[model samples]
Target chain A: MKNLLTSFLLIFSLSITASAQQHDHEQHDGHQHSDHDGHDHIQEADPALKVPNAGGAHIDGDNHHQTDGHTHAGDHGAHHEPNACGIVTHHEFDPGALAFHHISDQNVYNVGPWKFPLPCILKTHGSKKIEFFSSGKFNADYHMTGTNAYNGYVLYEGIVRRVVGDFPDGLIDIGHNALGVEQEEVDGKARDVVYLCHNGNKLRCDNKSTLDGGLFGGGITSFTDFSITKNVLSMIFMVFLMSWLFLTIAKRYREREGKAPSGVQGLFEPIIVFIQDEVAKPFIGHKWEKFLPFLLTIFFFILGLNLFGQIPFLGGSNVTGSLSVTMVLAIIAFLVTNLNGNKHYWEHIFWMPGVPAWVKTILTPVEFLGVFIKPLTLMLRLFANITAGHMVMVIFVSLIFVFSKNGTSVLGGYGTSIASGLLTVFMMAIELLVAFIQAFVFTILTASYIGAAVEEHHHAEEHH
Target chain B: MGGSVAALGMGLAVIGAGIGIGMIGSRAMEAIARQPEAVGDIRANMILTAALIEGAALIAIVMAFLVA
Candidate 1:
């Protein structure tokens, strides 16, 4: 009745929203950002400059910018001369900073000269961020470029600037070690080389300003921006909505006893019971109900994330697919598992039942290592599987290009394309299954660890 | 240097898991068909074995990623 109508409306609304999102993608093949259009065509192209594929321009010697593995401004030749006062200024984009793990051929899709669009967005940008493309276009300064493949980069509010240092060598002390306010002598006068906290790009600074037109438009956007997509937002909406609906129904069910669980409640009761019986009962025994709320929440949340990732336009913004994100989730599980661990569990690890005292001393470190390893294993398993599925699919599709490049051998290209396409389809189908299994494995393992943690001899006997 | 070899190991591990799960599923189905009334008992055993297989597969995958 009431539950049925609510569910019907929910489904109806979700389908409508999904279709609307799909329509936007079909309408525009590039990034789905309505806000991007607001900051368009502000900077006229410089007539004096021609876009060159100089890889990236290393302005501060830290390779601040890169294009095709080549830096434009080679080594900052003149600027390298040490200051007369012996004070040196060093600027660098901390070496080994996280960047895209580009899996396809380096020459996939070129934007301007050096910038390449990755198949997926790996990082996020804030409101005051600016992203620079090799094409001399910033998301804040340019309109939609002719290139359509850059649909992954989401540019929010930001500004772009290109400036050069003019201070004399002896007085300009722009070193990282200088704390608080930096003092520099510029033309026999004290000046400031304000270090930009935005990305390590030499040409841009993502200024943080709460007020409109307050500072460096918020932040510098990445060349291939991929922070937000509609599917992610919708999926988030779905989870919260589902959670809210279920909680409401549970409350009502509590109020009305002896009535059959109806609609959304009916759908959820089985899953809740499954967690309680299959996960909690086996692990925690008598104290199962104590952790039921968290376990159920985690199970449903993870299940939602996995399923949402499979949506047509979601791509890999799926946080679960990200190793760092999954690592955090695994960390939470690790913390909870250890925190809930009883004294018996620690004793078992430190001093096992059958192992002699001498061996226990040696095994203590191993047992401790196992504690960290379990969650580390959880993070890697989910991250690798999801990422591998995507990478395999990408490589399979790229095979078409490989054949086409080596003398558009039509038959070979088509044959490989079709074969790879079929394999990709197969992989996608497997991915759907993997999604569920990974979520289930995570939930169950958490339960098992909890069970192991709390399993005292007395508790084990009582359960049996 | 080590990344690709480890990836290969990961692939092989997954292949082994597929085979193991396939064999388990085949046996479980055979048992269920032989005694329809004992489907519940067969399913319990099947799930337990599948979990064990998955545990091994997951551990191997994790190791491969770590080395990579």
Candidate 2:
């Protein structure tokens, strides 16, 4: 009954984590940016740079000076500066130049407001007609109309700009500027200007620049993305998977009592018993009882996280992929391993069984280094492996559409696309297996380390 | 690049450890299958041997990153 209750709670907890409502694949795919309601395109406002192509309404001319329609020898002989998007042209002597306009003369091509969702646009004149550009989501295609020239992204509705002057009238302004759009001139070449945009909304230049902010305050905090719904579900799914096996075994235990184990018990009992006998017994030795719970918790928790890494949406987030989170877990292992270490362990590390005093001093530092290095390696191992796996899967999946640039090449595109999908699925399946292996590895290692510290030196003497 | 290289080494390290561990498991299972009455003794020895192997594998896993 106790085991059954634990299994039930595990399933319930995982269900809460794996709840379909939370996995919102749309949000995970970065489609949330398409839902943006604000007008943030600064390039759409500039009339001179964003002239509709004479050939076709759909064909957008490149905004740079190299384009056919717009020509500028040096400064275009005007004090008017262009927006970052090259959509709006702001003049210095013109009315509202100081009031409605927010362009700064310094760093003439640089756009400010550094963040999005807030209605603001900052622009400045630059040496290059195309001042700032990046393939990130916030920046639009400066070369194509309703499409990204660089990334070939179709400009969805949410990416539309807010115009100030009437179309085909006086000066036209793009991008939402509640405080009136601002700008500045940059000293560097066209591409030299640092482009800013939100990771989620590439069209909105809202990412914190070097002048803005950092991704996280510290390494430890970076792992909290796991608290998201997708991660929770993946972890819970793994726990459910393991719990089912546990329950199957427990039922057999009840039925067979002292008789030979059958079915699920045969598969699982050995592993559980193995951990107890090999890892716990030798490490904790006489004092194993006190630390078993934590060891078990770490084992299960890591196993769940590793399993979570195999799930599609959750794996992409890189929860266990972050070095910080892994570091903390490794630190926990380190603490538990050392705190439970007996006198024999410390003496062996700092002093020695039979080594000379001079040799002992040299060995002590190496031993101390091992303590720090052990946890560090643990963090690196988990983070690197899982993050790489996720990255490869994302790239493989993306290649399907990315390589299909030709509108007519249906056969090649379809074949490669299907192949990529199959490969992605295969990798995901492998990832699931890896998740368990990594968790077991971490748990077993922790046990062994603790066991090492607690093992009797007399045993080593006898062996030698 | 450094990060990518670190990850590659990590994957290799884990794969190596998994293979080594699998061998121990196979041998232990083989022993138990042959002598059914010695299951308990075999189980205990298997665990101890697995732990020793795990320690070595873990150390190698850590060494995999030293090149980085």
Candidate 3:
């Protein structure tokens, strides 16, 4: 009866998400058509404003002219032309960009079409004072471009970016269609530079610096974001959920004592026992008990986050898929492995009793490199697998848009939706397997590395 | 142009990984058939080996992305 109830609940939730996704697509289609109509209306109204091709230089020149005209016309008549600058032109649907955006971390928790704002904590480069406010202060539109700038910061695509030049304090109406992107050369490399238009002036915007150090085209900028973003919120929620669940199961175990596990305990026992028996005991030998807790924690933590990310329309928080998260996990594993390394392990890496001095010279450097490479591989493996899974799923869904030519063809949209839906379901199932496999692989590899570090030197005697 | 070349490199890396994993799977299957009782152990080892190969391919793919 309980199993039936659970299955029914799963089906009900799945249906809800499916319908919500359909509605979202319809709304998006409407938005695209409306924007196209607005663009047509603007072009028809003023023939002089129409350019044969809206290139970068042409747009800039036109924008400057419009801003000069706005100043001469005064503030009252400025409301007559909302998109006077005409920056927000119709762009083709880019699946790659969309996939990246979906997987990337954001300051807002997006559920369906509704965006819930999170608190924003930011610090400027030279300022000692940290600014605190809700992201809702930006009054972000459907496209996540803020209509108002609060304290010189504007929300662009659900992220808070600081205006480059000096601006007034407090809420200032920047109006819609203010944000624009252009390619600019920085350090001999061309990169996208975001600019904001407000009050007849265009201002550059700065993105927060990333620790990747330009490897991913991210480096130092004007401000640093210390906000509790969507990924951070998801992690906090998962931590609480896992704690409550384990506490209840632990309490059950204490009460039942030697009796067979039931309910949630039964569901978890096999998985925990599998890790203990198959992973820990086999890899770590008799000292497995000492490392069982660490192994179990990572296994369950990663597994939980992986499955949590798979839930449709639940913000799709790609926690484990993020490089930063996996890097930290790998760092922890590296620290634990090396810290617990006995004299024998160090000797094997640095000297090697059985090998000759010439071989040692070559092997020593390679062995040293291997130590870092192990953890690096662990980080990359988890990040790549999860990210690729999420990207593929996004692209599969994007196929509907691709075939329909951005909602221009109803027949194509309906035809592709069925195929795309099936593909998404197939991918989801594979991703589910990948979630478990990846978590297990991470744990087992860590255990094996630990096992090698702590293994006894009985084999040395035989070699000697 | 760089993107297309990077994609070609990524495909080459996948080819190498695919071959490596396929060999591991076939060998593991043969071993499991001969010694049915050790299927569990063989499967675990197979997956571990496949993951290591996948790690190499992942590095190549990431390098490709960086190049692009």
Candidate 4:
């Protein structure tokens, strides 16, 4: 314990010293008005200039100028200044921006610097003007406005909206003031300007001009987006994986007849047997074969997807975290439970025998209500549990970014990261257990629902 | 303002659920202690009861989310 304590202390102080160096470097840049950030983008396009930031004329455009009062070119950063998604952002690792980007559905999948647009499919309500194209065509960040158009629809975040304004209404003083957007003179025309928040919400213009927020307006646009979002993609991937695994296992059973279980068969046999014996046999009874397939499929599917959610490399396309997915799963379970309800099951619910006539009146409505309640509860339980786990994990990881970010001291960032990292790991460890236990519980409960539906209570306290 | 009220509602739902599940567990243990032979059946019943309690609490939580 003493050695362990010393090592931890060593790690702690080392991080503090490292962050201190970063702090000094940041301070030097801050004094220079953070001109490096502006030039960094320019360097990407053209790196011929040795002194990338020396081009004083670069401030002419709407590149939300970061130039200082020290430079004669105009302190444009003062007027166009944004608070970086309503929070002071010191760097690109703004947790608020990163958090929502991870949470919400986007039309593009970004892995490091290489970004590829997911295919966006939208159809007109009645006109039937089907538009299918790569979401990258709007140039990733640019909104289809005025002269620029992408198949007559403007993409905002991921919502396809119709652009109707001809640039005049946005420029008018009445509309501009109403929406709290400020205007600037550009090319002999007054233009309303608002900066995009990290998650792509249009906020009042300031120097925090993120490219995500530029498109926010236009006309009578109606289109249904059937886009293949991240969760959908993850679900599709799971379906393919499960199908392949089961099919190969089915083939192996035929090839290795009467032999002891080995390889993939040995791997899955125990879980399959456990579900059949413990979960299916007792609750589902003699007809356990009917529901075993579904129970096994969902058990592995949910288990696989939950594990996928924990993987950082998957880009946070948490399939089960979304409520719609859980709702659909619950609905399927509900149908199977109710549709397969034996005659005796409905008899007990509708006109319960052994109960008094007056008691039946009160019990009947309650029993009826329970039919809907069971499925509703299943939906909520799965959705809430999975969503809560994800939110907790994200919040824990974001603590590192929040502390070390601009305005918040780097030492604080390092300190919080160490503390939060420990907590995050603890939560992650619990998540492993939760991932399995919840799946088991969900499966067992589903089995119980079917069991209750098919149960004949007449042989109570009697031998089999 | 709305968020805090929703949080309060969720807290109440959880507390009530905790009490209910505790009762279910305690009663189940009592039943098991008396009839150890039927432990499998008893365990299944306990889980089902606990799931029902959780289900009820989750309903309230969803309502609170909508309100907030």
Question: Highest lDDT, which number?
Answer: 3
TM-score ranking, high to low = 3, 4, 1, 2
Model no. 3, DockQ: 0.68
Query: DockQ of candidate 1?
Result: 0.17
Residue A409 of model 1, lDDT score: 49
Q: Please, what are the lDDT tens digits per residue for candidate 3 over residues A1-464?
A: 98985575456434534544564475455455455445554456455675563688887787687656544343222222234354442234678978987888888888978989899999988999898999989888876778889899988877789998978879988876788666687866567777787776778889887775465578888899999999889888889989999999999999999999999999999999999989999999878999999999999999999999999878898999988889999999999999999999999899978788999999999999899989999999999899989999899888777776655566666677666776787899999999999999999999999999999979668776
**lDDT of residue B44 for candidate 1:** 53
User: Interface RMSD of candidate 1?
Assistant: 12.7
Rank order (by lDDT, best first): 3, 4, 1, 2
| Per-residue lDDT of candidate 1, residues A1-464 (tens digit) | 98985575455334433433443343233222321332231122212122333334423332232321221122231112223333222322111111122211121222323332322333323335443233212222211121121212212111111222222211122223111113455434343332221123221112222221111122232332332323334346767877797778879799778988888778888878877877777666777888888788777777777666565323344446665457677888898889989898898777875677889888988998888877877776676566666666556555554553322245555455556555666777898888877776777777777778877677455665
- Give the backbone clash total of model 3: 0
What is the DockQ for all candidates, taken in turn?
0.17, 0.10, 0.68, 0.40
Query: Which DockQ-derived CAPRI band holds candidate 2?
Result: incorrect
Candidate 1 residue-wise lDDT at A275: 77
Runs of candidate 1 with Cα error greater than 4 angstroms are: A1-239, A251-257, A399-425, A459-464, B1-68
Model 1 agreement with the true structure over B6-59: per-residue lDDT tens digits: 889989998998999999999999998999998755765566567667657877
- Ranked by TM-score, the better of candidates 2 and 4 is 4
User: Which run of 10 residues does model 4 chain A get worst, by summed lDDT?
Assistant: A169-178
Best by TM-score: 3
Residues A245-319 of candidate 4: C-alpha lDDT, one tens digit per residue: 888888999999998888888998988898888899988887789999999987898888887777754565667
* Model 1 CAPRI quality: incorrect
How does residue A111 of candidate 4 score in lDDT?
A: 54
Q: CA RMSD for every model?
A: 16.2, 16.8, 8.0, 12.0
How many residue-pair clashes does candidate 2 contain?
41
**Interface Cα RMSD, each model:** 12.7, 8.5, 1.5, 9.4
